[model samples]
Target: MLRYVTVSKNSLHDITLVALIHDIKFNLIKLLQ
Candidate 1:
């Protein structure tokens, strides 16, 4: 159970990071336009 929780937490962290990167990319594109 502990391992499962840890894995889920890691996945959530990765998702958040991806989301942040995506947002940054989107803003950069907007600025370029």
Candidate 2:
């Protein structure tokens, strides 16, 4: 049960990191344009 909780937390963190990177890339593209 504890292990499952940890795995979920890790996945959530990864999702947020991916979202942040995506936002940064979007902003960079807009700036370039």
Model 1: how far is 13 from its true place, Å? 0.2
Record all residue pairs in model 2 with backbone atoms less than 3 Å apart, i.e. clashing.
none
lDDT of 1 by residue, 1-33 (tens): 999999999999999999999999999999999
How much lDDT does candidate 2 score? 1.00
TM-score of each: 0.97, 0.97
lDDT of each: 1.00, 1.00
- Per-residue alpha-carbon lDDT of model 2 for 1-33, expressed as tens digits? 999999999999999999999999999999999
Worst 10 residues of 1 by lDDT: 1-10
Off by over 4 Å in 1: none
TM-score (C-alpha) between model 2 and the true structure: 0.97
